[model samples]
Target: MAKRSLPILSDGAAKKILRDLCKQHNVSLELVTQMIEIQRENLGRGRQIGITQDFSAAIAEFLDSASIVRGE
Candidate 1:
């Protein structure tokens, strides 16, 4: 049997990839970082039962509006 290994990404590489993705998507890295922080805070608040419905709804609304703005 042949063995295969997955390629590992360093922190710099990961950050560059994320930056490239943000650029490609026409979104600012700061906006993406803020979204991540919001999600993290929600997860902390709802750790016992997972993310709250309100948080999920907010995320859905955000995505919906983003798509609308981008005409996607």
Candidate 2:
């Protein structure tokens, strides 16, 4: 199977997603970078990006968790 290009996310949105994920997972930016690399590598082997369904949901979930953590 061949891989396809992923939908391009806005830089701001992507940065926010990464930040929220790091916070939610109690991980550092370095770990987030690693996780993202892992995610990309896993998907690319099968010609995909992140799980289409899971990616947005995961980001949303992370943001929700971050907001709660911040007492928002």
Candidate 3:
């Protein structure tokens, strides 16, 4: 079997990607960061009881609703 190498991004590149994504979505970096933390916490809590959910999609929907509510 051939060994496969994983792609890596430098810290600067990662930050740039995040910044661009936030700009493209017209959302503040702080808001996105907070949502990510909340989603992670929820996922962790769910895992304690062996519950699994497609939280990524849920988070996206939440962000959309939040943006609409904020008139963004």
Q: Model-by-model lDDT, in order? A: 0.62, 0.60, 0.59
Cα error, residue 54 of model 1, in Å, equals: 10
Candidate numbers sorted by TM-score from highest down: 1, 3, 2
Write one digit per residue (lDDT tens) for candidate 3, span 1-72.
442322222367776788798899786666566555555555536353422344455567767988799899
Report the Cα lDDT for residue 47, model 3: 55
Which is the winner by lDDT between candidate 1 and candidate 2? Answer: 1
lDDT of 1 by residue, 26-64 (tens): 866656655665555555353635445645665677678
Clashing residue pairs in candidate 3 are: none
Index of the highest-lDDT prediction: 1
- In candidate 2, list every pair of residues with a backbone clash: 3-47
Model 2 regions more than 4 Å off: 1-50
Which scores higher on TM-score, 1 or 2?
A: 1
On residues 2-72, what C-alpha lDDT tens digit does candidate 2 reach at each position?
A: 54443322367776787788689786555455446457766536656555554566566666876899899
Candidate 3 off by > 4 Å: 1-10, 47-72
Local error of candidate 3 at 33, Å?
0.4
Candidate 2 TM-score to native: 0.36
